[model samples]
Target: MNAQTLSVPAAIRARRTVRHYRPDPVPAELLDELLDLATQAPSAWNMQDRSIVVVSSETGRKALSEAAFGQPQPLEAPVVLVFVAETAAWEAANTDISAQATGSGAWNEQFTAMFESRAEFHSLRDRGLIRENAVKNAMIAATYVMLAATSLGLASAPMNGWDPELVKQAIGIADRDDLAITVMVTIGYTDAPPPHPGRRPRERTVHTELYAG
Candidate 1:
């Protein structure tokens, strides 16, 4: 079908996870608008810990491709966006700490009060409900970005099939372990419509109040 024949609804429904991408370049403004739209995603308690790093340069894309287990899509796509979450951002957003307060001791009590409900938060980095909440929020933000790309006549694929540590290093993240790379999304034009992954019917998946027993 011709471009004009494809309706907005059709485009929305047709967009899919594109693994292979053409070399065609995506306009800088479009990428900016999509990322800007993604920032609107709500975070846990509105902390907005989710941060995005957009890679548009050929050299940067190559580095990301290496980090992503040699996934050609990262290099081929006009844009590769890395979603990162600063674990400490939650605390930093709530209370501004002076330069003097910079250790496990200095902020231990602060975080203790913040994530007291979860047992995992006592020692683990991202194992507690509070950290889980951050992860969920970051995923939601990436979803907004994907859907926005679909709306803007673009195809996108969100992939987590890579080494997080390598990605952090390639992206030049200082504290690699503290900031987690939640997801990676590649966006660009497509030569062919992607194969559909059909969804389940609403009746089977949705419940009115409680689940059927």
Candidate 2:
């Protein structure tokens, strides 16, 4: 099926966790397109902190499966996407952001100086906050990938039950202190679709104006 034929609502509704997948490999061109769309997802200060590693080789898949506590999805799917967050992205992005702002005639010298000062202070004094924000940014991109894959008639399963340290080692990034393994998403064609367990109603989840409860 063509991705252009699917509406956003249809894609969202059709998406399901696919634990079993066919042996066919996802085409490289399609994968690249999907990733490009996934990158369109928003990030704080346009930092674009998410980094993805595509694992398709049998050896790499085997290692990732072990890291994921022997989950078969990693081995069964033709491609496993590992999303990592660069916690230092904000620091690296600050200069370019200021440059772009200036180039676009949106730059405020005083504001830019204050923002950089605050960002540096947080990086040095509030490391935990920076890491948390980076993880959130990465997850947002992962969600986009899942939805885009679904629109392209591919199956996907997002897994979080893996040991972070093991995953880093499996992906050969164990020594990268600036990066955090955020999540893993397995994507491919699936013969069996997981049952839709359904979602909670808005009344129970959404709150209007203020929290009534």
Candidate 3:
């Protein structure tokens, strides 16, 4: 990673969907730091159910590349992060979060009791809400990792082309039904600088109160 880091805004602008990467490896310490920053992303109810499996080994990257329909990014980048959303983890995390929140005076007994109903709120017959919650939390964390990489002068690519079942097998968690592979991000060094970008007019895309049709 380059020591000349960018400011937050600069990093936001610097991040690119890099497909080509150099073979230079990301240090273990730096990778750990990035992962730590990723977990700092906000979670619903502070339950913090987001997770990532670091796919660093060559064999793992090979599997991930195949899972991504033979995409070269996973194979080219030195590190690939597998973002997993555990739909069932939200209910399991409630107890720990509730207890901690109450202990910290952020929640009282009555408030904590109300929080338990969140399970019922998400437990529709179709389980759609549960999956939605999980994916939202996981994506936020993945975004953090992407920006953090750019801030450190590293390159990253957020990939959505992977087959979920194949990804699960790549991570050795195929038997688990509650987990969903929301996204994967490849992080490494890149020689190519990001190209200039074009954005829609703010008036057209950014509505004030309600959406503009």
Count of clashes, each model: 0, 0, 0
Q: Which model, 2 or 3, shows the larger TM-score?
A: 3
Q: What TM-score does model 3 achieve against the real structure?
A: 0.90
Tens digits of per-residue lDDT, candidate 2, 35-154, equal: 898888987666677889999999989889999899999999999999999887766536877787767877578867765665653764365578878888899999999999998888
lDDT values of the candidates? 0.75, 0.86, 0.87
Each prediction's TM-score versus the true structure: 0.76, 0.88, 0.90
Q: Is candidate 2 or candidate 3 better by lDDT?
A: 3
Residue 209 in candidate 1 has what lDDT? 90
Top candidate when judged by TM-score against the true structure: 3
Candidate 3 local lDDT, 1-213, one digit each (tens): 456878889988778889999999998878888998998898877767778999989999999999999999999999999999877775553687888899999988877876776755466315657777878899999999999998987889999998999999999999999889999999999998668576777787888899876
- Per-residue lDDT of 1-213 in model 1, one digit per residue for the tens? 113333456656767999888888887777778778898887654567778898888988898899888988898898898888767665443443322233435545565455434334344455455556667778999988887788777889998988877888778994666678889999988888677888888888888899963
Number of backbone clashes in candidate 2: 0
By TM-score, is 1 or 3 better? 3
- Candidate of highest lDDT: 3
Residue 95 of candidate 1: its Cα lDDT?
41
